[model samples]
Target: MRLTDMAPGMRLAKDVYDPNGNVLMRSGTVVTERLVKALRSWGIDEVTIEADAEDAASAMLDPKTAAEIRALLDQQFSLSNRDHPVIQALYGLCLERALGNR
Candidate 1:
């Protein structure tokens, strides 16, 4: 798939292959400019980008909805921490749940 084939908000994945068509990039490597160029040159614009398929397959969730869910979960689960990391994680969880990603 070429970059042109990619839709708005679509995630991307790349596979770096040697001359033998062997996979070079190990698992979990995110896309970068160099990688995109290489893939485009090869006429392969889209590879299987790793998304939280679990999340993507579920409903689409907005940030506002995610926040509301987070607040409710925090209250219900008794997650009292207000620190950045904790809050962020909780926020992410809430987003996932709201999005049906979890």
Candidate 2:
């Protein structure tokens, strides 16, 4: 969830950690206005929130969409050696950007 869209009383779906690896807020913590402000101050821009079964299902990529995304990624990286670590990382970034936009 976007930090700006989050409201008071929403429960976190995952734990939030600081730059130093300390847990800032545990999973299942109920959000508060103060906590939101603190998160913003701490440079947190987004977070996962608990969702219903339907929401979780809808969030997933269907097989067709997954295949399309995979094909597109493959075409984009066709000229690069898939075994190279840097190319692999770039492909992952491309995949994330494509999925996020969709």
Best by lDDT: 2
Q: What TM-score, computed on C-alpha atoms, does each candidate reach?
A: 0.34, 0.51
Q: What's the number of clashes in each of the models?
A: 2, 0
User: What does the lDDT read for residue 26 in candidate 1?
Assistant: 51
Let me know the TM-score candidate 1 reaches against the reference structure: 0.34
| Candidate RMSDs in order | 9.8, 6.6
lDDT of 1 at 43: 58
Candidate 1 stretches greater than 4 Å from native: 1-20, 53-102
Tens-digit lDDT track of model 2 for 1-102: 667757777788789998899899999999899999999999888776665421333347675786698798899888999999688656755665565566
Error of 1 at 2 (Å): 5.3
How would you encode candidate 1's per-residue C-alpha lDDT over 1-102 as one tens digit per residue?
Answer: 234433344344435565678885655565566666666776563355444542453335665665576577777657556567666555554544455543
